[model samples]
Target: MFRRKTTEEVPAQTEPRPERPGSKGRPTPTRKEAEAAARERAKLAQDPKAMRKKQREMRVESSRQVRQALKSGDEKYLPARDQGPVRRFIRDFVDSRLGFTELLAPMLLLIIILGTGVLGENMRLFSSTLWIVTIILVILDIGWLRFRVRREVRARFPEESLKGVVWYAVMRAVNMRFLRLPKPQRKIGEALPERYR
Candidate 1:
């Protein structure tokens, strides 16, 4: 009765602990492997020429992708101006219609030839008249295109901004079909899809 009882102490664990969820599930890397990896990293860091060359190659590839995208009308690689469904719809709409502005380039060339007296002095008056007529037609065509594009854009994209859309459509309409960037997804008079994206 005079002797006090002692509490038993638990033994320290010797077995390996269970892996936690999301653990790597492998043994830690050895010192040699770690040293090798560090050395490789240092080697890459020290080689400025190789790094620069790699960067240049990447940029060239990126440029190539952008050019291809512009030609093919792929949305992922298109430039800022050509991106978005609204711009695409505008491009298709402009491309599908034959506008008088497309004739302006060839007419201007003819005017230049006539002005140079290569076609004879009598052609000069004709050239001036043609110039005036072409200008008037272009103005009328642009005005009509702006109105139609604005109306369609409003109907299709109710909440979208109309800021530069009319101008963008006009510019696209001004270019000859073959010369247009993102190259005319819709053919002349082809019905456009309900959605552009």
Candidate 2:
């Protein structure tokens, strides 16, 4: 007897369908559900206290990173003043020399002590002479440093801007070797590397 199969008579397929390669493998969220999720996110974003805390935390983390960069000479996190290849070259140039200005601080302190008459009245004239000599030496050294830095920078970075670079080198030269930010990469009297990019 050729009869049509009844609903109850048909066998159910138990095997799972194979998934397509690009399928998400889950049901898409309904519009209402998606809207609710977006609203929750917006609410969190709009919370003033939470936003302030997050911003403050971010600023602290950024400052900490910059400080670490300054100490370690990590170029990526260095502050704007210390950034760029030209500044780096200037730093290297300055650090390689033993400048007289580095001693200026101690010389000034000695001058101050002598001026205070703590040592003796007789020492005052000697202190004045020492102060005058220190000033002259510092001025000469700085002038030389500026001239040399300008010449080298011009030769090495012909296309780079020289603005503020001479001053930058002078300032770095004035600081004690151990106190310089972005700590010296080259030793005193060490020859600078040919390329600095």
Candidate 3:
């Protein structure tokens, strides 16, 4: 009976939704759909009229690079020893020169996480526990796979530099989903052109 305060209604607190359009989007594509969109943009850049103008451009020379790279060795592109450090770094960074199947999905997950935060909201990419858990799983999976691959490399080439951890934290992203028509080639990170860089 001596209590001075009575029960008061309390207002529920809500999370503030981050503003958008007002803010520029992160530079890289965060999802497969985004990457597809980027591919279409690339096609348009290569040909403003798209297919109409695309018919005029010659691709015979472009495929030559792929052939030359393939013919060069068991590994695509020139050997790292022969290439400039910059080129070699780019090659190793992009193509998952470390391991293929194991790294594919993990790299994709990483790119999405980083891409989401490119604009402003530091928490934009991971506003919830779900995203955080997904990222953690990706890291664990990649770490586990890399450890296994490195073990094999060590066993096979014990005397040589058998350790090439291809894990990169950067937003380096690139994809060419040619089969998905009207999609631009999506490339992120250091590979980004100087203007975008």
Candidate 4:
């Protein structure tokens, strides 16, 4: 039966509260555990001198690989301009043909020397002749390159952006074949498979 209680009387204590569950995340570590972990981390830390030496070796190896890739025209490691299959094809196509643009560098050198007024009165005629010839040949070569590359690129990659492709091809063509980087993959007059042509 319920007891009648005096002013000082108290109710019996309720059952002790149940323990709260721990969080799903890692629990807080004890002092000994924390100290042991700290010691392990210190032991595993690398020496600064050795770490630097290892990093330098890694960099040197990486650079060597990149150089080899560039020389061999490995698509995976090529610069952005030469990375894509379309660009590779463009390079090959430009390289495999002989075009007037191949004379661009030499012709430019001639123009520069002639324009310096060293030949006196003949300078004007010489400069004008060289300029005219350079312009005509370069234009003709670029036009032909654009037409051929556009056709082949369309055949091979119908969805590729034509934007900048013409310039890319023309620039490659303007340089002598041997001087071009990622040196020509195909021989002169060597054709791509019939589907690409």
Who wins the lDDT comparison? 2
Residue-by-residue lDDT tens digits, candidate 1, 66-110 = 999989999778999999999999999998899998888998999
Residue 114 C-alpha lDDT in model 4 = 84
Encode model 2's per-residue lDDT on 11-88: one tens digit a residue.
799998786756877678999999997986687698988777877988999999998998889887998999988999
Total colliding residue pairs, candidate 4: 0
Off by over 4 Å in 3: 1-63, 67-127, 166-197
User: What's the CA error at residue 163 for candidate 1, in Å?
Assistant: 1.1
Q: Per-residue lDDT of 1-197 in model 3, one digit per residue for the tens?
A: 89788688787878865646446544544799888978977888877578555545535544555456544422233434423333333333343422233344555666567657765565554445545565676566556555654554455445545334333212222232222111222332334232210
Judge candidate 4 against the unseen true structure and give its global Cα lDDT, from 0 to 1.
Answer: 0.81
Model 2, which residues run further than 4 Å from truth?
Answer: 1-44
Find the 10 residues in a row with the least total lDDT in model 1.
19-28
Give one digit per residue, the lDDT tens place, for model 4 in 80-148: 777777888888888888889998888888888888888786986788898998999889888988998
User: Which wins on TM-score, candidate 1 or candidate 3?
Assistant: 1
Highest TM-score model number:
2
Q: lDDT for model 2, on a 0 to 1 scale?
A: 0.91
Task: Report lDDT per candidate.
Answer: 0.89, 0.91, 0.45, 0.81
- Selected candidate, larger TM-score, 2 vs 3: 2
Clashing pairs in 4: none
